[model samples]
Target: MLVTHERLAELGILYLEGTSVESIDRAAHAVILSGGTRLGYERLLLATGARPRIMNKTVEPKSRITTLRTYADAVAIRSTLGPQCKVLVIGGGFIGLEVAASAVTKGASVTVLEAGPRLLMRAVPALMADLIRAKHERSGVRIVTGANVKCIDVNESCSAVFLEDGRKHFANIVLVGIGAVPNVELAQAAGLATDNGIMLDETLATSDPDIFAAGDCCSFPHRLYGERIRLEAWRNAREQGAAAAANMLGAERPYIKVPWFWSDQYDETLQIAGLFREQDALIPRVLGPRGQLLFCLAADGRLVAAAGFGSLGAIAKEVRFAEGMIAQGFAPKPEALANPSISLKLLSSQHRSSL
Candidate 1:
């Protein structure tokens, strides 16, 4: 379904569809090879995204088991499913939980099996995970925690998952909601420096000064974490994309933004404004059912990260406060952050000398 120039002219929008890069030999001064193939360009910016992780040993690469990574995957899953289907999701991370909730709303019986003890164990706090457990179960989604799957038996029509505890769950459909790995084979094959991902410095410049990489495919130095970290969130990707573009224009800018990620499952929207270090302690502050913020404090008493389940506005305020602290090189008292209504403007003006 490649929307050609003629086809695009017929419609209101300039749509280009199904035109594989193999056929389209583009020639330009600055070419961006989005789908591979050489586009003669002085500068190249690679922003290839990541793909979902699914093991063949656990699930057979058949029609029954699927990974919801792209739009095509979502369409395939939705088209082949019905209200009477029983969907067994393998992972209980953000993707797994969101898919299970969507499936349940579509009248399918969904059961989420997570190997970890709690849902979203790596992202949210323990108490927030418990709250999410209650929310999922209340919406007719059965969740099984500490579930280790041994194998997946798949026929032509369906699949039956076997657990280590000898429990078998029959499923008309199965979805693997695990994490993703960066698409850096092209860079690696080209002899570009890559460690875990395409290694880029603070300026988003790859090992090759003429080449720059961004988005999930490149691992750049994060000032907040004081190390090279890869972020897969949309905001990070967009910022990295813009940074790569700016660097290509000879702008001397470095990528030093804080990492943030947000997820929406059913009625709950979780927003995390920063990354958490391993030694950071969690400070829980519950502001009612609709608002709660978890502050991750560093050893030196500075707020490293702030995670909120239902408090989007509060998360923004905290992020602003953190950014201000970074500008002044001053750490605030951990106890002072307890007040939700604390004014960021006042904090920025009054704390100038101390910072």
Candidate 2:
């Protein structure tokens, strides 16, 4: 999704097309393609990524409703949206909000419908969600939460979204961004272990020792989180791909990098580092170069995650220290965290670990 064909060609990369791997014969150490081609390999890495999760099967045939997954999907969406176009976004996750913000920028009338009670319920804390919602509202976007979308009715020209609460929103464009489904059909057919994603070890190797996986398609044990997680961020995928490649070459290295993600809507830059989902409390710190800092602290007192909105320059700094604290399982007093007098560096140094 990040690279273009022209760029790949410029880098002297051999880009293959039309050849699809039908199945993998692990016993024979070969992959059979649809064109009756069999390729043998000593090691294999699966970076299959994911597909956009379908919110409703009934609306799959609707031409107005589009799921943002590929560059083509974005092109199709932009084609439908124009000035004064009523755009209805389903699923208020990252993709939905981003699409809504972009639609607003294009002079489209945007309305975001989220089934959950809060925006970005699974991704960010309630406080951050509130800030994001307010930010979008100020940008002239209508965000409706606790909206239960029953189904979509489509016609020759426009479509209407029917909600369970007896509300119907008519729109010329619909964007779905609920979640993603890991592309694990190949791994499942090959008898490799599978969960919500392909299961892998800390070394990023699948159950089959010769088969390794990375990116959004694989869930590996995280030594830091004490559990397994499948990160969908571009940075995480890039780092994991490199680590998996090195390990596939017989360099045994565990993929234990700290997890982080970022989002940009309007003029604000939002960043989250480490496991923010586990935080029990929010600590607001006002010691950044451009904006205030909101720290997500676990119940045990460690800074599990942190987000800085405003200057990308300052957010980069806070996110770095937050990563260090998360790595050492560092815990500081809430007062210390809220106090701007104590920098994140001081807090990290005062933690149990020397680093």
Candidate 3:
């Protein structure tokens, strides 16, 4: 739905629809297709993306239990939701929370189960997570942390989720959003180097120089963080696709774009830019009653990341400025960043002027 096949064709793209690449013959620089067709490429870019992580392979029901990944899966989930429906989400991450919010909006009774001590444990700081949890709770979403799901028992009418702590919850529909696994089977079979994902250099090239990988399927080095990172965000995927194409055409430019992610649940928008750790020094900037921004600084006081939570109008521009600061490696005074009276735009401009 994002783009039509005709639009892609107009861009001089072949637009292979429903065709699967059976195997890659790296030695011959060609890929065998599902119908025994051989397609040779001067440079191959793999944007295979990722698949949703399954909670329990054995306990998976034929119906009722599902994971959201494709548009079809979303439609199926939406069809099952109603005022009388009871929805159980088995993760407290972005996808699970977002689904829970949508289900609540649809008049479904929603409950979120997080195995971790808190929601968004790996993504955001505790302060922001707490605020997000409060907002969801206020909106009638029941969130249970430290919930270790043992298994699911499915019956005709409903499913019973059993926890390791000897508690049970029942729901008409069970949605799992634990995480995702990068699709690297083809790359791995081709003897390409892969750690967390298809290993790519700054130029997005795979072990074979002619082969490149992008999006959620590849892990590239982050020059700012000095580490390898694989982002599952859509913006990261879109930007990486462009970068990979340019590199494939001999642009030879390093993919050094700042990491950015955003999620919308209910009426609130959460946006984050750059990579940050829980241990990073956080500086808070208050934006009236319903908005706040947190800046994460490294031990050396480098502006590593920023997260904003509020209405789109309240935080979007500020977060964008913070993203530029992170990208430029600007280390503004902690006091200046914490003061809401001072504009982030002004700070960024001043930093650039000083340089």
For model 2, residues 1-355, the per-residue Cα lDDT tens digits are: 5689999999997667877888999999998989878888899988999998876643646555678988888898888777969999998988999899989988999999999999988767777788889889999999999999999986656788999989999988777898899999999999999988999999999999999999999898988767889888889999999999999999999887888888888877888887666536888887555666788777777667787766777667766787888776787778987887777777776674554
- Estimated TM-score for each candidate: 0.83, 0.91, 0.97
By TM-score, how accurate is candidate 3? Answer: 0.97
Q: For residues 252-323, could you state the per-residue lDDT of candidate 3 as single tens digits?
A: 999999999999999899999987785679999989777889999998888999999999998999999999
Could you tally the backbone clashes for each prediction? 2, 0, 0
Clashes of 3: 0
lDDT (0-100) at residue 320 of candidate 3? 98
Q: Whose lDDT is higher: candidate 1's or candidate 2's?
A: 2
Q: Pick by TM-score: which candidate is best?
A: 3
Misplaced by over 4 Å in model 2 are: 1-14, 287-290, 349-355
CA lDDT of 108 in candidate 2?
Answer: 97
Descending-lDDT candidate ranking: 3, 2, 1
Please state the error at residue 303 of candidate 2 in Å.
2.6
**Whole-model alpha-carbon lDDT for candidate 1:** 0.75
lDDT of 1 by residue, 1-355 (tens): 4457777787775333553233212234333344764556577776768888765666555555688887889898888666988899999988898889889888899999999988987766777678778888999999999889889987766798998899999888888887788988777756679977899989898887877899888898877667878877889898888988888999979887777787877766777777766688777766676767677777777667766676455455655565555444445555655665565455556678553
